[model samples]
Target: MRRVALLAVAAPLLLVACSGDSDKGITVRAAQVATVSEIVDAPATVTARAMATVTSPADGRVASLLVKDGEGVNAGTVLAVVDSPSAQQRLAQARQAAAATSTGAVRIPRVNLAGTQAQTDGAAAAAFAQSQAAIAQIPDPAARARAQTQLAASRAQYAATQAQARDAVRQFDAGLAGLGTALRSLTAAQGVQAQAAVAAAQATVAALTLRSPIKGTVQLGGTSAGASGNLSDLLGSLPGGGAGAAGAAGAAGAAGGAGTPAPSAAGGAAGAATPSLITPGALVGQGTAVATIIDVSALGLQADVDETDILLVKPGVRAKVELDAVPGATYEAAVAAVDLSPTTSSRGGVSYHVRLTLGAGRDTAGAVVATPRPGMSAVAHLLVRTARDAVAVRASAVVRVGSRNAVWVVQGGTARQRYVTVGTQGEDLVAILAGVRAGERVVVTGAERVHAGQKL
Candidate 1:
């Protein structure tokens, strides 16, 4: 019975070995001579070379919008007008104070004793002296009496004149003192304060008018208060004075004043020129962005490279850029910059920003291609290393054996373990420096199942 059981097990084992599924063979591929390149691919974005945001200098209502979105504008172009009543009032007060202080007489008064009062006093003294001398020379009682009376009259008149001269001198001195005080006041701290007020008022006035700081296309920006018809449609209607129709309604809303809702929040008509965020009567605070100007003539690509591959990228390295917007077209580019600092992704991976400059390329007929716009999605392939006509094999065909690398070569339905010295390992291919020749079949998968000298 034991012998019978052994025979039964051996018969089943023999049949199982002859079955089609019993053969565990490995897949093999021949090594080929081709160019292998080590490249790092990263997502990129097309961006403008320069961009600027125009902001409100102070809190105020937007009185007028001079440029619409997508409109071409030059540097210093008027973008919008802000109506700041408070600032205007402040400026008016400052100007009034300046004018009041600047319009007064600035000349210094001169005080001297050579005036009519001094002349009159001198003449009176001389006359009185002469009269006294004549009286003393007179003789006879009647004549002397008459002369005495005349002398008395002359003395009284001289006394009155002297009093008048003293009064005149006092008045002249008082006037000089007053003039000096006035001259000192003009050059004193009050004068400097007036000048400062005027300068501040001028600056406030300038702050009310927003202007484009760069030459480029304008993009309207601000906090949206309410929904209007299409935002773009409202901007388009500005050149046709459609905003005036909305202004009438806004004025009605403004009549409610302070506590009432903003007029812009009460949606306007279908064709009004009021901006989605800022309208004619809308209030904006200082430093609020009013518009954006982007210089689109020159564009570049911004890519984020993984931390592991960042060291392989450097300035002036050649790159190939493919844009999603312009499908099937590849452009030549060069690395312009790389951020030394790294940034962390949401998933905790580290990355570094790399900037590239796009170059103009020609087509097969040598025609210049169209330039890509800003904000387009792009992919950049940075060439790290390249080997021309190199003996290369799939990376999976090589396995790490202790410290060195080895591959399983299959010949005549048998496997042989061979050591390979690899120069550069790419994403899918590895360049072999030795121990592997072109057109040799190497086992790529299932190498663990086969040993050296194992038959397939």
Candidate 2:
């Protein structure tokens, strides 16, 4: 009887100890009302608002470089001068030809049909008069009769000659008209040729002097081709058309090689040379880029978003950007554009390019921060949705039970599993629409350590 009483007392004490241990082992926090936002994160690259590339207008030796790299310049600034003796000579010749054409001294030989007709008429009259005199000189009685007949025949011959002279005059007039038309045509053609030559020469001369088309910093060098010791040397060394010529080879390869052929390295080299096509002394061909000018007044970010998440991104959406170069700085941004078309990777994954405009940002103390430069690596978090003043809990506190979302609620120092309907889910918090109320203590961490109806 004594042993049984002691056992019952010990069992009650052991039960109390077990309950206290369960409560001590688990962690719980009160659910709170707060705002939650859904965001999509993407890696991004910084770029300038505008970029201008200046290319060589013609094949020539660089005579002088007026601007250095990173030098600020205005539009129409003379950046470099190229010298082509051949081009200069051509221009001079063209100018002379144009001057000659503009003057009226040049004329086609004119035909005088009226003067020729007058000469023909005079000859015909003289022949007829001579024939009449010769007939009068022949006089013997029978011979006189023969002279009279001959005189009649001479008269008839003179009349026929007169008609032939009129026909010759008409033919001469028609020939003269055709000759005038030909001369006019020749004159017009000469004038057109002169004008065209002058225009072409002027263009060539202007191309020899490189000018900046935009107001920005001057980045010296020709596109992808390494700078030569001098412009002449560069031009002489590179193949005609420089690196741009490789494009044709690449195209041919694509057409004949079933798309499996790699692009020519020469083409890539040409592209790299584009920014620095012509140095102070390097030679470059026409249409080859000599420098690139970047406008940095406005900065933007370019990022590739996964195809799955692209649909949620659209213009005008608010975003937050963080630069890799400027740690601890966050810039406010907006989605400026989202590409409708997607780019496919070698692995067959598709991604769309997204552009964002960076706005002014402030530090934790509310002071303005420095603007990021182009080419900076960055990350952006775009806000997709937001829920205001919603009942929410730490994401860890919510657990999936079967098909329903549930949370472990602590009431009377014990955990109770309750099903909750979730709304928008954020990175760290989830909005609750049902089952859980604000200020309710929920098991956030160590929830797996406790079961339903267990002490928390």
Candidate 3:
């Protein structure tokens, strides 16, 4: 029954870890009652906390190289200088424009128009009291009542008239102030635009002195190391590489808009062979790769899980990772976050992105192993669901026949097809909810190829 709940969230793919043995090309194993767990196998990539790439802000030649590749430098350290005359000229022009729009000498006018509604309300009340007093001598009840009602109606009309007048006066005053407000708004807008242009020009000029966005060891002219994110992080977060522990990547990005491109682009820089143009007096273009800083203090993992299985994988779920480069080693990690947006591939398959904090790694003998380098290919086996004491069979025995799952059961030397409802699926075993019973010999391998009523 517990396995039934996992059917909707479990992905069709079986990646559960288990042990199995096959006797022949067509092996049949007796269905046994065992525990099985559903797994969401996702491909993951090692990502750094931050890999800030520094680039030239303008098209100019390198005037000086302050830091060499592979040197440890502090944040805001000047790495290189590009002497761009155009950048300086733009700064001068922006300053002039800003000075022209300064409104210090001109005053912003104030407007106040007192309304007559209050005075009219008081006068109308006094006049109504005088009318009532004048009518009190009419002792005839019916005539007096009619006279009072008439006075009330007249008073109401006078009240409405005064309200209308007040509204008119308000509209007139607003019209008079419209020109003043327009003038103030125009002046403010001009000043804001001028200041923004000046700031941009100043940023460009300052970028000429390329500064290290973070405190880290620099990598000389080599392939621009990609930032600390997997392809999934690149798609989902798109900034600061993938977010990790503190002191990882914050410094790699910017010193409050110093004109350096976001660190994400650093991972897309030139090759390992330092560009010959990086030396002093070499010409370079705008946004040219200058250097990179890799923060090794922290690392993260980005995994892509199929849309069908993502729901079961949540924050804090544990995962065992296997890297292609580090064979026979398993790493421990836990889910940090799951991306709300889905990443659709060209093949039309949709998957949700997940981020995890990388932990330690162990080898086949349970000995500690070295950590994997960033951008390493890895497979994450996320334990999403588990079923215990269920009717289990070899995973290979189950075959998808159109909309249903079935197995080829060998009964008295004859093989027959039996449809079954499955629960949690594992690598070597699958938990069956119904149809095939325990001790039934089912074809584990070649189940898809076998026909019903075939002689075994």
For all candidates, the clash counts are 0, 18, 9
Q: Which residues of candidate 3, in runs, are more than 4 Å off?
A: 1-30, 97-196, 220-258, 264-276, 346-348, 365-367, 396-420, 434-456
In candidate 2, stretches whose alpha carbon ends up further than 4 angstroms from where it belongs are 1-28, 74-78, 85-206, 222-280, 286-288, 344-349, 360-370, 401-404, 408-419, 446-456
- Candidate 2, residue 102: how far the Cα is off, in Å: 19
RMSD of each: 27.9, 26.5, 21.4
Write one digit per residue (lDDT tens) for candidate 3, span 234-276. 1342223334211101111111121343444212222233443
On residues 31-123, what C-alpha lDDT tens digit does candidate 2 reach at each position? 767777778888777776665565554456678988888888876777777775544555566567556656753364455644544553453
Maximum-lDDT candidate: 3
| Each prediction's TM-score versus the true structure | 0.56, 0.54, 0.56
What lDDT tens digits, residue by residue, belong to model 1 across residues 33-91?
76677778887788776666555544466899888878999877878887766445555
After superposition, candidate 1 runs with Cα above 4 Å error: 1-22, 89-204, 222-283, 359-372, 410-416, 439-441
Cα deviation at 62, candidate 3, in Å, is 3.5
Worst 10 residues of 2 by lDDT: 1-10
